[model samples]
Target: MSIATISTFVTAALVLVGIALALLVGTVGVAAYQFFSQNRRVRVARREPLVGYYRTLAFG
Candidate 1:
């Protein structure tokens, strides 16, 4: 085989490997974010806060 042919094959292989690595990293990042960012707190507010009320506080 010629040097040019070998170079082309190596380039293609490297590109494929790079794409796979990028996809794997992106998937892992998204999964980690979802897992670590899980919100277990109860998000329901019983009532809305009044305009001048201090006791009633609305929160997520």
Candidate 2:
């Protein structure tokens, strides 16, 4: 094959690879954020009532 044809193929392959990687990273990032936020909310929900009770006992 000619040099131009080979280079064109190489360039197209690289672009496709880049797009795939970006999509993969974005999916993982969103999953991680959701996981962490869900965990955080659970922790806060479990703690909030205890905190309010303490504040009432201490200040009232």
RMSD of each: 9.3, 9.8
CA deviation > 4 Å runs, candidate 1 = 39-60
**How high is the lDDT of residue 2 in model 2?**
100
Q: What is the lDDT of candidate 1?
A: 0.64
Task: State the lDDT of candidate 1 residue by residue for 1-60, as single tens digits.
Answer: 999999999999999999999999999999977753452122123243333232332231
> What are the models' TM-scores?
0.64, 0.69
Whole-structure CA lDDT of model 2 = 0.80
The runs of at least 3 residues in candidate 2 whose Cα sits more than 4 Å from the true structure, single-residue gaps closed, are 45-60
Task: Give the worst 10-residue stretch by lDDT in candidate 2.
Answer: 48-57
In Å, residue 45's CA in model 1 sits off its true spot by 16
Q: What is the C-alpha lDDT of each candidate?
A: 0.64, 0.80
On the 0 to 100 scale, the lDDT of residue 24 in model 1 is 100
Q: Pick the lDDT winner.
A: 2
Give model 1's TM-score versus the native structure. 0.64
